[model samples]
Target: MKTEGGADAAKRRAGERAAEEVEGGFVVGLGTGSTTAHAIEAIGRAVDDGLDVRGIPTSFQSRQLALEAGIPLTTLDAVEGIDLSIDGADQVVDDADAAAFGTLIKGGGAAHAREKFVDAAADRFVVVADPSKLAARLERPVPVEVLPDAHTVVADRVGDLGGEPTLRSAEGKDGPVVTDNGNLVLDCEFGPIDDPETLAARLSRVPGIVEHGIFVDLADTTYVGTDDGVEERQY
Candidate 1:
């Protein structure tokens, strides 16, 4: 599960499977990241194949990509329930011994807020990832999206939690990368998270915090691509 194209391929395959599972004229919630890019590509293929679908993108970049792919765009306000959402994650934990899935941490791209919004508005949420992302215990730095103006305040608050917060940025870009919501992203490195749900709740409650890249138990299923093959997990 080292760095390779297998994860992206797995993501693409999962996206294709999810796209085929969708029904006619359904509203689709799109997510962000490299893996999600594959999902979007698959959705584009579905559209090319004549599937009636409308997409709601979670990020500005994602919106542009979806439009470029010829997927019809729409706002969530106009759509009621999304048929399904295909997204990616920073980490996914599966206790095969316990036969459980859907335990995950997302928001690597600082699109967690919108992704969460879309996930809540969907009938089903599917997470795609590589087997390397899985762990015996889910542990990773949780990302937090904040208002640029609140950077100082949030940083101080993050320190109280024994976490180091760094501003998220893109190469060749000055300042922090602002989200579609006009908020800044902070990569809060708290080390291995003991309780993702609790941490998510705490960070989200902080003022000037627009959103955090932590997703609780929102996924219904997850598809992991491995060198051996693809693995499916359902909550």
Candidate 2:
């Protein structure tokens, strides 16, 4: 167990460890969120030290961060494929078999839709997190990005799937939170998801649902920071 400040430090350690995977001339995917912010900063420092890497940011926030960190930027259309992607996870479930891929629930920052695209395009998708993010089963609400006009319909469909759906609202704004893709997000609570792959597929079939936050069979490895040190788990 760790105190609040210790947890933040652990996350930074995990982020730094993940940054070590970067190599010169590699096209990396920059992910959004607090944990990945540390990785972005580490990568920026490496760039200052002569690490020549181009970044494909997953969101506007990441793009801005990369700019401030002095990391060069590129677009998905400009690259064939990304060498690697390091992102943060809201929840991580490591499979029992090391050969099997693990599950991740993301979109805490409302950027999972773009994050998934960049992550899937990478040769390896690595998750960086603090120990508190690891879970036996995913209990968080899966965020579903839907077309603004389709939010009502999508909410009904999600409810039919045994989830309680709530439109993610902005903290300072009056309306619902809109994603970078100009879509509405539905936070659907499906307690302790047993089969994320199945649920993801089912959600995909729902019309107007652009993407879901349930990342299934995508993560190649996870770097978790603990009181002892950074722990690596390969999926």
Candidate 3:
């Protein structure tokens, strides 16, 4: 859906803030999703401006976008210890309690596994989003990435958690959506996530589950863009 007041403008604001937070010879962790497209664009501009940055994109789509943006690309073999990651979110809550330990919820593009890995590896993860994406509570469903062979198994596990599981499918595509890692994505409809950190921990213990979209306490800070201006929340 097209966002009001121009989503591109919001993305540029958040991307600029994300760029300002990084430094020289940095290994950047990039995220997927439309909003993040703008961040990638900004990263390319940063490269042009002589910022020494190389990116590790979270998804194939993100990688292509990054390459198109003219940002230098590298792999984990080339650079150890990512300096920072900047990504967009479907919903973001910057409460100190929620983001204190680099936790968050992402994966609207079904790239949760890589997003989680990148977040865990980064020293700082900056989530960029428009102000409207903030939530009073994490009431939306969490997306879970699972092995294709374990779809039923994982769905049963999620059901035990009082959630209904449905395989996520792309537009006009049949069957479950497969991630870059060749896993299936299940949308777990848990009405409200009271304790995101706890839920994230619990999901980690589930067998056949590659990664859950509930990013708990991983976000060091969130840069929210609004029509009025941009704001920051430290967690």
Q: Pick the candidate with the highest TM-score.
A: 2
Worst 10 residues of 2 by lDDT: 93-102
Put the candidates in TM-score order, highest first. Answer: 2, 3, 1
Better of 1 and 2 by TM-score: 2
- Report lDDT (Cα) of residue 214, candidate 2: 92
Q: Which of the two, 1 or 2, has more lDDT?
A: 2
Candidate 1 per-residue C-alpha lDDT over 126-216 given as tens digits, one digit per residue, 9 for 90 to 100: 8878777787656677778888899889989998878898888876977777777888888888876666777778888899888787777
Against the reference, the lDDT scores of all candidates come to 0.79, 0.91, 0.81
lDDT tens per residue, model 3, 1-235: 5444566677678777777776888999999987777788888888888888899999999999999988989886677789999888878764455432334577779898888788779999888888767876676678899998998998998898888999988778777678889988898888877777777778889999998888776778888777656788777
TM-score each candidate: 0.90, 0.95, 0.91
List candidate 2 stretches off by more than 4 Å: 1-5, 95-101
lDDT of 1 at 199: 79
The reply for model 1, stretches above 4 Å from the true place, is: 1-5, 96-101
Q: What is the Cα root-mean-square deviation between model 1 and the actual structure? A: 3.1
Measured by C-alpha RMSD in angstroms, how accurate is candidate 2? 2.3
